[model samples]
Target: MTTLPDGLHDFLAEAGWAGGTIEPLPGDASFRRYFRLRDGERRAMLMHAPPPHEDPVPFLDVAAWLTANGMRAPAIHHAEPEAGWVLLEDFGDDRMRDWLDARPGDERAAYEAAVDALVQLHRLPPGPFAPYDMDAYLREVRLFTEWYAPAMGLTVDEAGHEAAWREALEPLLARQEPGVTVLRDYHAENIMLLDGRSGGPQGLIDFQDALVGHPAYDLVSLLQDARRDVSAALEAAMLDRYAAATGAQDDFRADYARLGAQRNAKIVGIFTRLAKRDRKPRYLAMIPRVWEAMERDLAHPALAPVARWFDANIPGDVRRAQGGKIA
Candidate 1:
């Protein structure tokens, strides 16, 4: 197994370095690690990604684009090409989640700020830097059936459920008129609560996976969060907010509900695969809430067949698998 890189501390120190206070930070996902440094009043972050997994090129490109688009993603100060190591701008881990959660009722205001940030992000021109095209979106949508379906231990159900799901995905996919460069995972976790942000949005991080997708996908990510539940009223309010701004109120409910079903179904398979194959059990607990969201979204007329498939064949067997009796 390849170990993580030694980071800037050892890299610079071994060369008789004289500046930067370095300290290793905590809470890295299973695949990566990070550290922070204070160098002559300038704060920076060091990310270490070991071999067989680590690649920094995408992060560099996406961060540059988001920064250029008026978002405060940290700048890449230095890097070691072959080592899979990089020194990046330090946007402290003051995530929107933590800041909003502490303030209680302030969740609405914080979420509004988040929505505004997203609006600005989604309305920007898609440059060569932000290449979110149909091929990529289709491939990503296929992951629901490609990886997640098998992970769920369903032996390819009759009526070709996967095929039906794929069929359902087409109309909505065709309706997308790409507005802005989409950051695929625009949620509270990836966004930082900047100290003094003056641009079009808040600080952004971990946006290497940015893609051009249906704008609704990110909106679904924010309102239909897997980690925490935002209430129904607020969720509706957000939908109205985005619709009014875009003037696309033509069945926004159906649109969001369809998108929500698509997202939640994809996540179900993903969370299961994570627990079973990747050994990431934490995601499994979040699956139930996502399932509930799917159930609600599928209530609309557009998702009748998709909802029927779930109702007849599967109503969350994972919960039963976890020793909780199915109702």
Candidate 2:
């Protein structure tokens, strides 16, 4: 049996879950850890988001907002934000990614549902979160220059990187209205396939970093997933579906491609940081996949400036990810 974290038992006891058996669940790239708590027929998910590194308040706030808006964010049963423990309604083990892996034929349906969930979410007004603005965008892309490039033993032109991204992301930043709530990480793994829920069957998790951003952002995050491969055909079809549903067909493709490039670039940097700074080398193996998606996005005309920057800075051979310990 896995040993529980200190004060976990007393904490659970305080929440009326004293004797529940706790079992750790697989974690994500972040510092948060999840566990299943069972006391006879009662069940809940315990999120251990230790302080100074992780915060449960944002998760609590976002969950309340989503559920209030008719979305399927997990219901929060109890929380002690200071210590970073939250007891949530368990949505079960059927993550969209794992589900599709087991039932390959259900890919289209699963993706459609995921896309529709975004559609439903996009229709709502912006949330009480920070805008995914230029500063934020540049900050994220800088991860590539700061971490990934150096780790790869390549010195990149940081000024050129920022200028190219600023130009490329200009269109996205010009939206007149406050954008929809972007569940920053809305990919397959963060989505749970809850049975029998209508209109919004997908259960959202890992959404503490939700932002008010362009509608295209979450779609890009979903289609150009870093952890999984979403095929080109499916990506195109879903893009079309979102555009059709939202009446955003005009320039929507450009925006999607642009965000895809930006997001993938950020992931490449984040993965490198995870490996080098945090000593989690496993994320290094995922860099190639992120690079492939970023390359695809760069092919679009919308990403010309950023693509040119890549052409000038990172060469073909160096663009590829290699397996090794970062010194």
On lDDT, the candidate that comes out on top is 2
Q: Which runs of model 1 end up more than 4 angstroms from their true locations?
A: 1-4, 7-21, 28-30, 129-154, 196-201, 315-327
Candidate 1, residues 1-327: lDDT per residue as tens digits?
334355545665643333766677664344667777776777778777656687777787888887887877887777764666777777776777777667666677777888888777777876454544545444554555555555555444544565556555556665565545666666777778777332224787777777665677789888999778799999889878887787765655676777788777667767766676777777767777887887788788877777676666554565245311212
Strongest candidate by TM-score: 2
lDDT tens per residue, model 2, 32-140 = 8889989899989999999999999999999999999999999888889999899999999888888877878888888899999999998888889988898999999
Alpha-carbon RMSD to native, per candidate: 3.9, 1.9
lDDT of 1 at 133: 50
The lowest-lDDT stretch of 10 consecutive residues in candidate 2 is: 318-327
Worst 10 residues of 1 by lDDT: 318-327
